[model samples]
Target: MSSARTVHLLRHGATVRPGLLLGHVAVAVTPQGIADCIRVAAGATFTQVVSSDLSRAAECAAALGAPVRHDARWRELDFGAWDGRDPTTLPSDALAAFWRDPDQAPPPDGERWSALIARVTAALADLPDATLVVTHGGALRAALASACGFDARQVWAFDLPCAAMVTLRIWPDSAQIVGLRT
Candidate 1:
């Protein structure tokens, strides 16, 4: 009998500015972030490990163990001109509109919601069985939305704080969300 394959999606630890829009930025994970990753690593078992090419995710993946393969496909949504800006700095109306309809109102030059979901779904589909994917919050949300039948707006509602984890059992025929681990 074939065993069910488990995929663990872990959000990277805290960034320099937790509230900033850090899409595609190579921000270093904080010391506390490293500690949180170490703590998570201590309790879990993974057959394979992968991470986004971004520094924060990569560093967290490394903390889980060695042989971490970084993939740009797993990177967070590229915010383009808004990459490192604080959301508070943007016009409230524009920000609200973007949040309400991300696919239609993408950040200037940034990736659209549909594109992000497609890329992240493809990346997850290509992973090995029992894999651990260390990535950004946006990437994790995209995966959740794809695998768990969540809508774009509902994906944003998920509070995937730093170092949070969500597990899914994926099979050839279907996928089941195991649970979220804070």
Candidate 2:
């Protein structure tokens, strides 16, 4: 492993609705989400705060009381046609197929998981020594998965709770998972 750079990856606060993909949609944080994120990051000493342009992520970053850099690259996976659809309503085979090999699957006209991985990799590569990134759950998982060479199955296993903070160590050759939260 190379010299590690500390990264505090914060998942955005929860939105008003649940069980919806909400990909590329701009949804604000629920009241409870704002409170929870403020509580979690209140004591953190961060160098800088970066967030997705979406309102939910931006609101969470705002609670940190630091200037935030909003970037579209950190947005969640685009679900495209499935953005507003209920997962339960999709064909059973559809989910199974995607889960089996997410890299090859694109959600209708949405972005592929591989593309997400590549974009996140580039973002991390360009990050400074230490930073606090507030983004979507899927975005966090993509970073972790790429750093560790985790496959699609293992990537989905990463459970990022709303307003949770995960510490990641990024290196030139590899990355390490430092910590996680509820």
Candidate 3:
């Protein structure tokens, strides 16, 4: 028999501040969005459930009706001075540079992309055999980057929308994405 494990990474749903750049901000999730998240996780079973400590992600995780481990390692990449600001208000050139290589051009004082990968990698390492993680989009992306062996730019190809769930089957040395649903 194989010793592979399954990990379900789910991004939190819409927040009260929908369009703003939210990084490490404890913004609340909209009621409807919470309902949507609950619907998405309905019928799912896992031996362990985890979530980011941020309110948005934590609320979604709570709605799943499980005793969850709220971890800061799964928090979104902190946007620093740009946190909770309208992305449109930021300098286009800087934003473009961040998109090209976030670690090199991260928001002023924000958490670097590489740093996020490190924390998320550690968080994933501690997971049990069957786990459901309610986290932010960036955290999910960071996990994907590690699982798929994709670089910063290449990882953006994944379409992780609000309330989306991606299931990864992992072994000691490798991982495979078995399913994804939004």
Candidate 4:
């Protein structure tokens, strides 16, 4: 018999603003976001619940009444000087440069998408086959990109919504996206 694991990739609950490019910043979850988590976890069971160390993610895990294992590597990409900067504020050329190849054209001092992917991969390696990961949209995109064998640039197109859940079945050398937006 073949052994398989189910990984639940949950984007953290909603925040104060949707456009705030938050990276490593401590932000609180909106009340609705908390309720959304509860709604999602109503009768779900999992081997473990892990989350980014950020307060938003931790709080969501807490509301689920599970012992969350906080992992720094699961944190969102560090936006550095661009933290909290609205995307619309970026210069057109600069934005185009980043949109073209975010893995290389990083913000003034922000982390590259490749680094973020590596961190998330390492953090995920230790998880059991069946685990629940509460993280950010960027982290989820990274996982999707890795599973789909796509380049880092492809992750930019996966705009998952807040509090969304993405399911993946990972194997030794391959991974599959089973379901999304649960």
Candidate 5:
């Protein structure tokens, strides 16, 4: 067995609702968005492709030219009542607090920061070497936390634009970013 494993977590491209919290809200990805993702992964080979069951992520996984394993565990954090709502429209203080400490100020009735970390940690336990996970930005950040032990706020500092890809080399107790493509 290899001493380390590599996982590439690719965030799905821009969706229909560009600025809304998109958890469990199925949104269509523009054709150019898909092309952007494909271009990012162009010529990058992986042993396996897994994707969030959401169509936005699944479609990009399919475009990567591999049979995909759809796993809901990779789904984005449920925004609860805030799902599909623009942050600009919400109470600014509440939105700011959620960004500062999501666990403390989670979206009303939404999934907690702990919940997201838990599910993503479990998913990391079941992966093959050189795997590609086509997922959402929230899920991508969760993967960084799950594999590297970065806290919620620290993970948020990562700039995971749509179609951004983070490649990590994961060991038993730690992970290193091997590459990144935005």
Candidate 6:
């Protein structure tokens, strides 16, 4: 039997524009954000650290003092034309529809929710045991959905604030929620 693996999914620190859809916009994490990651890392020992190539996640991963493996597959949902745009700027009806059913109404030219889940799960599949992943909120939510059997709507309802960390105990055939640290 494969030994159980512990995967810690950490949301990157707060971004420059907290209210905007930052998909691939390359924003930096706040100073406090870096400190937040350090505080979390101080208590946990990880075998490997991975991060999305985005600066926010990468910077936070660097703060953990581990050699990071950067992968674009762990990136936030590609918002396409809506990337970096404030949600309030979009038409209310369109925005509401997208939120109500992201899988069905992705932003103009953006990645669908199903695509996001697939890529995030694929990245998770490649991680080593006892790994830490620093990524976007959307990506972390995808991990929760994939490992915890949360549907799209349920995943969206979760509140994964910036710098939050969730640990998952994974096996070849199953996964368990270890803990959540906000």
Worst 10 residues of 1 by lDDT: 37-46
Q: Model 6 lDDT vs. the true structure?
A: 0.88
Residue-pair clashes per candidate: 0, 0, 0, 0, 0, 0
| Alpha carbon RMSD to native, model 5 | 1.2
- Cα lDDT tens digits, model 1, 1-182, are 55678888888998877888999887888999988877775555688899999999998888876688888888999998889999989989878988998899999899998999999989988887878899988889898888777898888887889998888898765778886777
Best by lDDT: 3
Poorly placed runs, candidate 6 (over 4 Å): none
TM-score on alpha carbons, each prediction: 0.94, 0.93, 0.96, 0.92, 0.96, 0.96
Q: Per-residue lDDT for 1-182 in model 2, tens only? A: 45778888888888887778777887778889988888777655579998888888998888888899988888898888888677888777876776687668667788889898888888877777678888887888888887788877787787778888888777788777877765
Q: How many backbone clashes does candidate 6 have?
A: 0
Q: Kindly list the per-residue Cα lDDT of model 3 for residues 49-130, writing each as its tens digit.
A: 8999999999999988889899999999999999999989999999999999999999998989999999999999888888
Superposed on all Cα atoms, the candidates' RMSDs to the truth, in angstroms, are 1.5, 1.7, 1.3, 1.7, 1.2, 1.0
Clashing pairs in 2: none
Pairs in clash, predicted candidate 1: none
Using alpha carbons, what is the TM-score of model 1? 0.94
CA lDDT scores, all candidates in order: 0.86, 0.81, 0.90, 0.81, 0.88, 0.88
Cα error of candidate 2 at position 85, Å: 2.0
Name the 10 consecutive residues with the lowest summed lDDT in model 6. Answer: 37-46
Candidate 4 lDDT by residue in tens digits, 49-112: 9989998888998888878899888898888887888988877787678768877788778999
Selected candidate, larger TM-score, 2 vs 6: 6
lDDT at residue 94 of model 6 (Cα atoms): 80
**lDDT tens digits by residue: candidate 5, 1-182:** 44888888899988877988999889988888899899988745688999999999998888887899999999999999999998889999999999988888999989988898888888987888889889998888988888888898889888899999999888887889888897
Candidate 1 wrong stretches, greater than 4 Å: 1-3
